[model samples]
Target: MTRTWTIAGSLSVEPATQRTDLLAEPVAKALAALENHREEAGVAPIDPELADTAAFCEAYGSPLAASANCVVVSGKRAGEVRYAAAMVLATTRADVNNVIKRRLDVRKASFAPMAEAVELTGMEYGGITPVGLPEGWPILVDKAVAEAPELVVGSGIRGSKLLVSGALLASLPGAEVVEDLGKV
Candidate 1:
């Protein structure tokens, strides 16, 4: 399948390949797992220092609206802990206090601690994405995200970013498109 890249000035994106040497282990594994779906996904190398959404968008000339942020949220219910990955546009914030907490059927929901999120997902802080999250964890994609043509997201590490189709992201194994999942 031919992959389309909507890269900004001077940024080059290439098909995501099984390149463990180039990416973090979890990222490489996630890309490999996505092969079965035959979806078009690309990886663009970036300066690790500019991996944060705002910095990355500025450095790469990418629009903040086209960049998605994946946040890990956790809640407890019946003495059991539940985790979920929320994908929202950079312009908005995940409605963790309301939507997510309600969805998880827990009294409260909050962003997972950076160390816990990193350890659980095997991804670096500031670079945890929904694509390679642990099984049984739901991936909640905001309606806007699911409707976008394309988006830039984390690649499980700070050294690169993944460019993917929004529709494809919504179709991931555990993804669910939720209306009003994000709030300004």
Candidate 2:
């Protein structure tokens, strides 16, 4: 199957490697994430009412049960290398102290600023994906997120988003499905 990932102006039609959910690898992966909801094609609601993560899901007519994949700020004073990838329910936050903080062995871990996050991933802060990240970043995904029928991840760059399955995310390049990631 040929998957065509629509970008800002052009389209990406990669050869069939994994299931071609879309022409782009990211879109394909995103489509793959929606395996549980196979009947419903997990396409980004192009005309999103809002830009925030929650707004996207809600606008797409989702049950608001979608998870937001983010690069969390961790370690004392934040901005530390302890940057981790975390996916939490749109309704819940990560448990930092009891989970990621101790797990990363940091004195404190707060959210890294959007500017910093964007800088690190070479992608817009809101569009960071787990598949392609700078080396040595931590991925602390919530176990509950992986169990989700369909989770929303990044599309490499922010121009678009990927709605993939938790199982698919677990099998992604650098994704580490864990329940230890924390939220504030």
TM-score per prediction, in order, is 0.93, 0.66
Q: What's the CA RMSD for each of the models?
A: 1.7, 7.1
Runs in model 1 deviating more than 4 A are: 18-20, 35-39
Per-residue accuracy of model 2 over 1-184 as CA lDDT, tens digit each: 4333322112222332232432244444444454343333233424323446666555544445564666555565354456776667666777765677766778877777878776766665566666545556666667777776555555654445555566655655456777645343
What's the number of clashes in each of the models? 0, 14
| The candidate that achieves the highest TM-score relative to the unseen native structure | 1
In lDDT terms, which candidate is top? Answer: 1
Over 78-174, each residue of candidate 1 has an lDDT whose tens digit, in order, gives 9999999999999999999999999999998999999999999999887788887898899999999999888899888898888877786897878
RMSD of 1: 1.7
Give lDDT: candidate 2, residue 110.
71
lDDT of each: 0.85, 0.55
Evaluated at residue 23, the lDDT of candidate 1 is 59
